[model samples]
Target: MSIEEDRAVQAAQDTVVRETDNGYRVLGSPEESVTHQHDIDRIPQFDVTQEMVSGSGENQEAWLTYGGNYEMHRYTTADVIGPDNVNDLEVEYDISVGSGSSMEGSPVIVPGDPTVMYQSNGPNHIKAIDARNGDVLWSYTYAVPSDVVLCCDDNNRGPAVWQDKVYMTTLDSGVVALNRYTGEEEWYTSTADHERGYSATWAPIVHDGTIYTGSAGGEYGVRGFHTAIDAETGEQKWFTRTCPEEEFVGDSINQAAGTNWMTATYDEERDVLYMPVGNPGPDFDGSVRPGPNRNTCGTLCIDAETGERLWFHQESPHDVWDYDSASPRMLIRDLEFDHRDEVRDTVVNAGKTGWAYSMDAETGQLITRSDPGVQQLNMFSMIPHIDDGRRGTFMPGGMGGCDWHPATYNHETGLVYYKMHNNAQEAWWRFEEFEEGRKYWGGILEDETEAMPDEYNGHISSISAFDPTTGKLVWRDWIDSDTYLWGGTMSTTTGLMFAGTQNGQFIAYDAETGERLWEFDTGDAPLSSSPISWYDPDEGKQYIAIQVGGSGWLRRGKRDDRVVVFSLAE
Candidate 1:
C-alpha cells in the first residue's frame, strides 16, 4: 500500500468507546473530550506542528513530557529517594518474563501516577506496570517473527509518553503509538525496510508536538535517516537521509549507507534536533564506504520542522570500527569548559570511545572534549590514509569510553553522571554475509576473552561524574566489574545519583561528591535498567524503583527479575 493510504487506514481505526455520564456511552477517544487534540486527525503525523511545540509554560504537570526537561537530563525533582530513608526499602512486586538477549530498555515512570513502562529484549514486548503495587496493567508485544536481523540484541530502549499516548519503536522496523490508558493501537508506521538491516530499538523522543525517531540500518544494505511524525496521528512529516543519496547509479551496483539507531534531542526554542548516527554499514570495514561518510559516526543538528541538515560534526568520520556516536544527546545549561572563558547552554554527547564532547546546542559548534580517565588501545594508523578526508588514530576503540545507557544531569549541583565500562576492545577486518534482517558482523571485543566475565569484572564499574558546565572530570568511582551493561543514571532533587550495576547491586551516590552512600544487591546481574524516583502520596514519602533483571551482556552470576522499591523510614 502507498504510505498515504496506510496513514488513512490508521486514522480511521483510531476509535475508542468511553463510558458516558448517564447510560449508553461515548463512542470516541480522549481527543473528542479534549478539544485541542480533536483536530489532530485520526492518523498520526510526525512533523512537529505549532500545536505540539506550543503549550502553556505554566502547565507544570510533573515530568509529563519525555526528555524529562526540554533538555533530556532523565533526572527527577522528587526528594523521595534520599540517603535518610533509603534503608527502609522493600520489593513491591516481582514478575519475570522468559528472558532473551540483552535487556536494555530503561523503564519510565508516568508522572502524577503510580505507573511505569518498559520493554523486554529478545521478544520486543512493551509492558506497563502499576508502580504502586507492581501489577501488570497492560503488555503490548510487537509481533516479531522468529528470524529477523537484529543488530546488537533484539533489545528495546523504552518508549516516550506524550499527552496520554505511548510512542514506541519495534525491533521489526515499526514506529507505533498506542493509547496510553487502554494500550490500544492508535497509529503504526514502518521506518525502513525491515527485511534489510533496518530496525528500531532506540526509544522515541517527542518534542514540540513532533515525534523524532531514527532507524538502525547498520550492517544491512540500508541508509540511515531521522524522521519526524505528527504526535497525535502517526503520520510521516519528513525524513532526513543520513547518507549520500547518490551511489553508482547507472551501474549494476547501488547502495544507501548510514543508519541512526539511537534517539536524538530536540531544541524547541531553536527548532532543531541533535541526532547521533551509528557506524557505517559492513560494521568492521570502511573501505567499501569511501569518503568521510558524511553523517555517520557523529552528531548532527537538523532543523526539526523541515528535516534539513543544519550542521554535523563527525566524531569518527570514516568510522571503520563500530564506535557508533549513538548515545543520548544530554542537554545542559551553564556548562563549564576546562580551558575556556565562559559558561553556556551546552549539549553533552558521550561515545563508545569513552570521551564526552560538549557542544554549543544552538550552533552545533565544538566546545570541548573530555576523557573519563580510562586506558585502551588507540586507533591511529601510523601510515596516513590516501587523502580520502578520513582521520585515523582516535583514542579509545569502540566498545566505548561510555555507551548507550542514559546519563543523568543533576540540576542541584550542575553535574552529569554516567557509567563507563573500562576495557580494551579489539577490532579487525572480517568477511561476512551482508544481509539486512540477519546478523551481519560481530562487534569489536572489549577484551580477548571470548565469554563475558563470570564475576563483576569491568575495570571501572563506577559512575563518572563531570561538571557539564565546564566539561571537566569531577570524580570517578570504580565498581570493579568486567563490564557494566544496560543501566541508566537517575539524579534526584535530594542530591543522589542512583545506578544499577552488573554486580546485582543497586547503588546510590552523592550527586555532588560521587561518594557511594548506599547499596542493595538484587541478587542478579542486570543490563540497562536504572533506578527511577517518585513521591508516594499514600505514605507521604519518596522512593526509588528499579527493575532487577539479568541481561546476557553482563556477568550473569545470578538472576533477578523484580521491581524493587526503596523508601526512607519516617
Candidate 2:
C-alpha cells in the first residue's frame, strides 16, 4: 500500500483500537486487551529489547507490557496504590549506597517473578533486588576510568530485564547484559569513546531481540546518536546518529550536536522505535549549528528491525538553552485532535519549554500543545526561542520544561503526567575557558551581561496531566517552591500519580482530580529520578520506588544519595 494509504488505514485502526478496549490505555480495560482477537498471531511476543510486547495476538499486553506502557518507560499500569488509601503507604525499604550523584532509575519487574532490577549513579552500577523485601540479589558495577569527561550528572538511569538477562549501560560507555538470576556478565560492548566525552547513562530498551540505547555528551563537544545492539550476543545491530551532518557550517562554530542521551519507547504494532535526542554542543551557542537542526533535538521513529528512519520531528532547533531532546515519549491510541476525525496513534513528549507536544505517532503531525504551569517565557525568548518555537526554544529556561526524567501515562483516563518548573536564568557569553580540562561556557552565550529573570514568584512549578489526543489540560497539581522544579512523574492503572521534587518531597496525587493524595519528606533533594511502580506477588501489595539524590544544576550544591521504596502497611 502507498504511504498515505497506510497512514489512513492505521488511522482508522487506531480509532477502533482506542475507542474500543485497546491495549495500554493508562486507565483502560485490561480484560478487553486480553479478550480481543486480532489478525497478528504474535500477540504474545515480547519486546525483549524495549520491553514492549509486540506481535499480533489478542493476549499481548503491548500497551501495559513494558516501560512506557510497562516496558521501557518503567511507569506502572497497576493502580493498587491510590488516593483513598495512599495515606496507608509506609516506607518498606530504603537502600543507602553510600552517596552518589543522580540516582535516576526505575524499577523493572520481571513478570511472574519476584525480581526487579534497578541502577545507581556515580560509577555506573546495576543492582538486582528482591521485590518482596528489597534484598540485593546481585550487584554489578562497570568501571569507568574515573577521569572521563561527562557533560551532565553521572548517573545510570536503570536497566532492562529480558529473557532472564539484565541489561544496563555504564558511565564509561559500555553496555552489559547480565544473568538475571546471577549477576554474571553475559556479554558487553562499548557504546562510545570515553576520551571524546561520550558516555552512556540511559537505560537500555529491549524490544524483540535488540537493545536500544543512546549517548550522553552534549556539553563537552560530542556528537550523539542511538543504536540497537543484539540483546543475546551484545553485537551491534544498527546505529542512527542524532545530529546528521550539518547542512552548512557557520562562522560562530558552536553547534548543537548531542542526541539520544535519554530513554525511548516502542510501538510494536508498527514495528517502530521512538527516540528523543539531546541538545547540540556549546549548548547555549547556536552560531555553530544553525537552522532547525534536523534529527537533533527531536523525536525519531525507526523501523525497529531495519533501523531505518521512518519519520523525524524536531522539538528544539539550534537549542540555545541546553534543552536536550532526551526525554521519554509515551505512546497511546484513540487520541482526539482538533480538526481531525477519530482518534490517532500518538506520541506525547514533554519538553524543557514547559510544553507538552502531542503528535500523530504515525505521521509526526502536531496534535496539541500544553504548558506545565511554569512561569517563564521571556527567558525562553531571550535564549533565542526566535524561530517561531520550531527549532528549540530557550524559553522557560531549559533547567527543565521537563528534563530527561520520565513521565506517566494512565491508560484508564488517557492522561500523561510529568513535573515542570518556572525557572528563568540569564547567562552571559563566556569565551572558551579551560576549567581544569573540561570546557566551561556560560549557560547561554551572550557577549554582554544578561539580566537573569527573577524566578521568585508564587509557586510556579507543577505536576500536570495532559490529554494526549486533544492536548488539553486534564489536571495539574502545584507546589510552593523558591527553586525551579525537578524530578519526574509516574502513573498506575489503579489511578495514582507519583512524583518527586528538588524541595525534598515525594508526592502522590489523584490521577483524575490532581488532588494531593499523600506526601512524604525524603529529607533530601530528588532532582532527577522519578517514582516507579511495581506489584509484589508475594505480599500482594503495590509499591512505589524512587532514588533520592541531589543535582548541582537544581540546588547549585550537593545533597544525599539513596533509593527509597514505599508500600501499604502489612
TM-score for each prediction? Answer: 0.79, 0.80
Please give the TM-score that candidate 2 achieves against the real structure.
0.80
Q: Give lDDT tens digits, candidate 2, residues 1-570.
A: 121232212221222111111111111111111111112121122334432343211111212232545223444545567667889899988876443545666555553344343444544555555555666554545544534555555566677767657777866677877766656667779887766666777777676678888777666666667788988899998986665565436522233455677777877688788888776666665554557666766788878887787887777666667666666788776666656776787888887767788878898877677755466556445443333332322345556667776777776767788777655544433335423324533344321224434444555477788876666777776766555566568777667777887677887788888888888998745555766666655677776777777654434234555778888743
lDDT of 1 by residue, 464-517 (tens): 887665567898877675544556788877788888887777777888887888
Q: After superposition, how far is residue 552 of candidate 2 from its true place, in Å?
A: 3.6
Q: Which segments of candidate 2 are over 4 A away from where they belong? A: 1-75, 111-113, 250-256, 379-395, 430-460, 482-484, 554-558
Report the number of the highest-TM-score candidate: 2
